[model samples]
Each structure stands twice: as C-alpha cells, then as structure tokens.
Target: MTASGALDAPAASRPMPSLAAFTQRLRDRLIMQEDPATAAYDRIMRRLGISIGIAGIIVGGVELPEVAEQGRYAPAWWTVAAVVLAFGWYPIIAVVSAVSGPRAIRFVCGCAAMSFLGALASIPFGLKLHTVDATTVWPFRVTALAVTAAVLAWTSRVTVVYLLTAATSAALATVYTVSAVTPQHVTENFLRSAGLAALFVWCGTAATGAAARVDRESAIASRRAASQAAAHSRDRERARFAALIHDAVLSTLLEASRAGTKSDVLQRQAERTLEQLDECRGAQRDPDLLDARSAVLFLRAAVHEINPSIRFATRTWPGYDDLRMPVHSASTIAAALTEAVRNSLRHAAVPGREVRRTVTATVSAGSIRIVFTDDGAGFDLAAVSADRLGISMSILGRMRQLAGGSAFVESQRGEGTTVTLVWGGDGSR
Candidate 1:
C-alpha cells in the first residue's frame, strides 16, 4: 500500500471526535472570532448594538442636569439608583455585547424592561418620573424610549407587542401624573411618546431582519457552490475510470482473443492490464505535476502501447522544456489521444488500401498541443451519433473536464481525419 493509503485507512476507521473537542469554540466566538456561518448577522448586530449604545450615552450626558433637578421630588437614594439603572446600565451592556456574547444581550433586554416598569412604580410614590410639565421633561422618559426601542429592534413580533404595551401604559401614567390632566395633554403626550417608539421599532426591525436574510442567503449560496464542486469531481473520476477500462482492459482482451491464449504478447498485456487496475484502485494521492519532457515521453509510450506502427513526433520550443502542467491534464490528453488512435485503427484501414497514422505533440511556454491525423477511409463528422461515447465521452468529455483543456475533430468523406487536443493558453474556447 502507498503511504497516503496506509495513513488514510486508520483515520477512516477511527471514531468521530467528541463534543469536548469544540468547547473553546464558543469562547472564541465571544471574543469576535468569526464563524463563517453567522458572520453577516454577527457583524450587523455588533455594529447596531455599538451605535445604539453610543447614542444612549450621548443622550444621557445631555439630560444629566434635568435628571438631577428632578431628584428633589423623590428619595435621594432612589433617584441616584434609578438614574444609574435607567441611563447607565443599558448603554454599557449594549456596547460590551459586541464582544460579550448572548448574556450581555439579555442584560440589555432586562434594562429595557426595568426602565418601563420603574416609570410605572414611581407614580404611586409621588416620584413624578416621566412627567411632562411647562418647564421640564423627565430625562428617564426620553432615554427609556430609546432603550426600549433598541430591544424591539432585535426581538420577536410577540415581544414587540408586549414591550409596546408597557411603553403605552407608562406614557398614559406620566400624563395622569401631571397636576391637571386634560384630554388634550393626554392625547398629545401619548401620541408623541408612543409614535417615536413606533418609528424606532419599525426602523430597527427592518434593518435587523434584512441582515438576517443576508446571512441566510449567503449560507445557501455557499452550500450550493460546494455541492457543484463535489459533483464535478465525481464526474471527473467516472470519466477517468471509464477511459481506463476502455483503453487498457478491453484492448488487452481484444488482442488476446486475436492472438491465441498461449501467446507471450497476450500474457504480457494481461499482466500490464492487471497492474494498471491495481494502481487505479489505490490512486487516492494527489497527482504529481509533469514537465514538458516527461509529458512527451509518457504520451509516446501511451501511443506505442496501442499502435506500435503509428508515427509519433515531438516539437518543443526553446526554453520551454521546463514548462509544467498538472498530471491529470497530461493523463487526460493521453487517454483522449489513444482513444482517437484506436478509432482510426478500427475504422480507417480499407481493403487493399495503405493507411498512415501520425501523432504530433507540440509544447510551448504556456501551452501543450497534440494533433492526430490519419490518411485513410475518413468518415463524415456530422453522421456520428450522440451516443457514440468513444468520441463524445471518452475523447471530448474527458478533456472538457480538465481545467483549460479542449478537443476538436475534423473529417470529410473522401479526405483525411484530424483530431486536435489542447491545454492551457487559448484552450478555453
């Protein structure tokens, strides 16, 4: 067995790794180590949270004096504690959530809930929180609207309804807390506070929803690309296997049948066919690259194996002998060329007519080209059936599967036939 095969056998038989192998994965993500699956959503949420936190800090700083002035109407300790809870906690949590993970997000949600509840609780105690009068507006009232709306941005529709209900109730309570409540005052304050909350809700929901959709679509596209690559790889392997059977095993059987079972040439060919099959079974390692000289020699041996009488020639440009290509490309071209020669040998030899077959391989700095010509009983290319896999799958499809590889066939009824295979520069067409 090959070294790679020996190593892979043990790995393939081993059990899957335990869940403990991934324990640090969450910690890594909390520190901003991105997971490709949720990268888009995480990026959007991180930026949104940081922006809202910064905005909250700015609003809190601007409203500090008013908050302090309103403290006279409430207990001194309650006023200081409420200010910290309503204004200080959430913004810090929101900013830290960018690196802190889901618990920080939950804390921000708690802050939103507590701010609305605190406004309602202060009414019975004569705290006058969230009250709007001729001279002053409650600072907590304004900042609470922002904090609650920020939560709504990332929450579900059901939670949105619940939070909005709490906000509306708080707005109504603040209106009643005014010394002389009027229908006009209640309607105006209710609409202003609730309307601003609704606007933030709508904007936040839309932005977050769009970010989620982007992440979903990106994951789908990634899966589809991977599936397509796998399918192409499978198709290439199938083509290579089919070519091997057609060129080596079948050809050996035909020669053995024509020459007698006891023939030495038939025995040798059968042994070579068995060795090729064994190699194919273990061909799991990465293929080695082939330089120009090595590729030419390999092609010459391949052609001679099929038809010893066929003329073969090689032409290499100066300073291009060191040019290299993937081994798969070389193998694909060799298989296609051999298939073309087999087709010529089977169909071109007419009774009482001399047939000449030649293969020419040309190597340049950026490309490799091979031409196969036969001066024999040529057939029309248009009359060939689509199901004739010798031409379609083995020769054409095989080369087409290789990157930057192509094949062409040209023939006329009374003239000659030419099969051309190319790789690299100008081969895409």
Candidate 2:
C-alpha cells in the first residue's frame, strides 16, 4: 500500500505496535544520532560543575581574610593570585565550558590542570606563617574539590589519575610545611584531600556512566526492533504480490484459455491484466507524488483516523490545488501532525476539565502549513526529560528531516499547547 493509503486505513484494521517496538522506534528517533544519553549526561555534569564552581567562589570569598593572613608565609601577591586563580578564575572557566561546545572540555581540563600546578607551586596548600598549629583549615583544599569535579569533563581514567596526584601532592606539601611531621598527620591529610575530591568525582562518573550504558542498550534494542519491522513489511509485501498474481494474472489466463483466440473479450481482459501488472511494477519503482488537493485530503483523513473528534479545518489559496510535492514530504507532514494530535489527547485532556482540540491546514503559494491546537492542560517544557521523544522526535525531528519543512511546539502549564508544522515553500524539492 502507498503511504497515504496506510494512513487512511481504518484504525481498527491496523495492528497496534507492541510496547517494545514503540519504545525502540522512539529511541531511534532521538535528535542526536550519536549517544543521546551521553550528551544529556554531559549537559547535566556541566551544570553541576557550574554550581560547584560558584559555591567554591563564595566559600573562597568568605575565607579571604584567613587566606590574606597567610601572606607572611608565602609572598603576599602570590597568595592572593593563587586564591583568585583557584576560586574566581576556575568558576568562570566552568561557566564558559558549560555554555560552549565540545572543544571547551579541553579548555576546562587545562584550567583544572593549571590550578593544580599552581597549588603545588604554592606548596603547604594554605599553611600559616611558620605556625605549627594543625587545626587551620586550607582554603585551597575546598577549591580543589570543585576543580576535581570540573576535570570530569575528560575521561574517567584521566580524572582518577589527576585526583590521586592532586591529593598526594597536597598531603606531601602539608607534611613539609608543618613543623612536626608524623605518620598520623600524613595519613590524615591525604585522606582528607582525597576524600573530598573522590566524592565529587564519584558522583559525576556514576551519573555519566549510567547515561552511556542506557544509550548503548537503547541503540541495540532499537536496531533489533527495526529488523523485525523490516521483516514484517517484507512478509506483507510478499502476501500482497501473491494475491495479486492469483486474482489478476491467473484469472486472465484462465479466461483466455477457455475462450478461443478469436474472443475479443478475453483479449481485453488480458490487456487490462498486463496494464495492472505494469502499474504495480511502476509503484514498486517510484512512489506517486501528491498534488496540493490530494495532500490536504490525505492529511485530513490521517487526522480523522487518529482522532475522529478533532475539528479539522483547511484553507487553500488560488492555484493551491495545482501544486505538487514529493510523496515523502507529504507523508512526513502527516506523521508529524498525527503525533501532535496524539500528544494533545494523551497529555492535554485532564479529567474534570473540558478540552477542545483543533487542526488547521493551510495550502498557499506552494507551501503547506498545519497547526494543531488544544485548549487543555499544558505542561512545563523544561520539566520534560531529554530522552522523551514525543515532541523532539515525532514532531520536530520528522519535520526537520523533510526538505523545506519545519516544526514549532509552544506550551505553558495551565495554558495550552500549539504545534505548527510547515513544508514546501522556499528550498523545496
């Protein structure tokens, strides 16, 4: 069957897709062709880094006085510079890294490495001026925790090495700076520094790793489901071809054999059968394009099939019905519209609240525009999970893949949702 015919099929006649198959298709349609879960994890980690970086800045600012008092031990300017680089500059870099592209990961990692090296140079890691007191808190130690978290933008293995190196360096520096070094002191200092850094690193690593694993498994499952779908489509096509041959070719040949060669009726039947066969071959080779009228009708039928209750309206300008577009473009628009209506029905229809859904299709100036609107319970777009493919894949992604096609979804809690799909104006093929 043609794409349009499939859409026009009665809802009851169409077999419902299994839950696993539906889930697989949704995962496969994610906007990112690469690891989508990994991408989401990166975004989350970047935000977390920014938060930690900012917190470090605030903590450093509060400890500026204590940090300044250490001026007698280290050069005054050097002390202040270390504090600024570790707290102020580090967080600023984190903010930039979060907002920037992939290249920013290296930049952030470099910044973290510099901060660690600077801390090493200022050895003693926040030592008082020749004081033997072990009760003093190291301000740089707090900054180290945030920096370690930022380093997570790199590979986990690299981050682990950096954490160990920084922690060991801080411990040795503490031992050297104190007047009296003891085994207990060394172990305590090392554990203190490593513990803080490890906490941050572990959280980031666990979250990102889980995301990557989910993406990998989703990809595998989606591929398996796709293979099954292909097999089903092939089986259906084979059955259809068998029936066609039996009903048309066999009947025509039987009629011809029974009637003699002189029968004009048999000749006409045979010619008609040949023409039908040729048309079937042509359909297999190339899908038929839809004219503007046919496209509008197809979309109307599709919306009705999905939801018979929706109010569908169509507007056409002069010469609109004469325009023609590729079959794929028309089917894509229909599919996107179908998803929009489904979303409205599924999410917008709140109990005890009356909901009204409408679809408008406008064909004019060689372009097609469809808008699905619902006066029902809306939702917060930001609250939607990144992995959710309802709007991103079913609506936006499908339209984006079509030439000269675009989609927009707007919604607000307690308000309503409006989805607009457009295709074929400029840049159309």
Which one is best on lDDT?
2
lDDT scores in order: 0.63, 0.63
Model 1 per-residue lDDT at 419: 88
Model 2 regions lying over 4 Å from their true place: 1-39, 61-75, 124-132, 135-140, 143-147, 213-236, 255-268, 286-419, 422-429
Error of 1 at 253 (Å): 3.2
Which lDDT tens digits does candidate 1 get at residues 1-429? Answer: 000111112322333255622422222233222333454555556666666667667777877777677666667876676666556655665656555543455567556556646755565465654453433236425634554445533466755665566566655665555556667766676666667766766666676678779868865654453344344445655787899899999999899778754988778889998998998786542334555666676778778977899898888887575456655566668778877887777565544556777888888877888999876655557756565456777788878888888998886544557889988743322
Report the lDDT of model 1 for residue 285: 23
Per-residue lDDT for 111 in model 2?
71
User: Residue 357 in candidate 2 has what lDDT?
Assistant: 79
TM-score for each predicted model, relative to the true structure: 0.52, 0.60
Q: What is the Cα-based TM-score of model 1?
A: 0.52
Misplaced by over 4 Å in model 1 are: 1-33, 68-78, 128-132, 135-154, 260-263, 282-429
Model 1 clash count equals 0
Question: In lDDT terms, how accurate is model 1?
Answer: 0.63
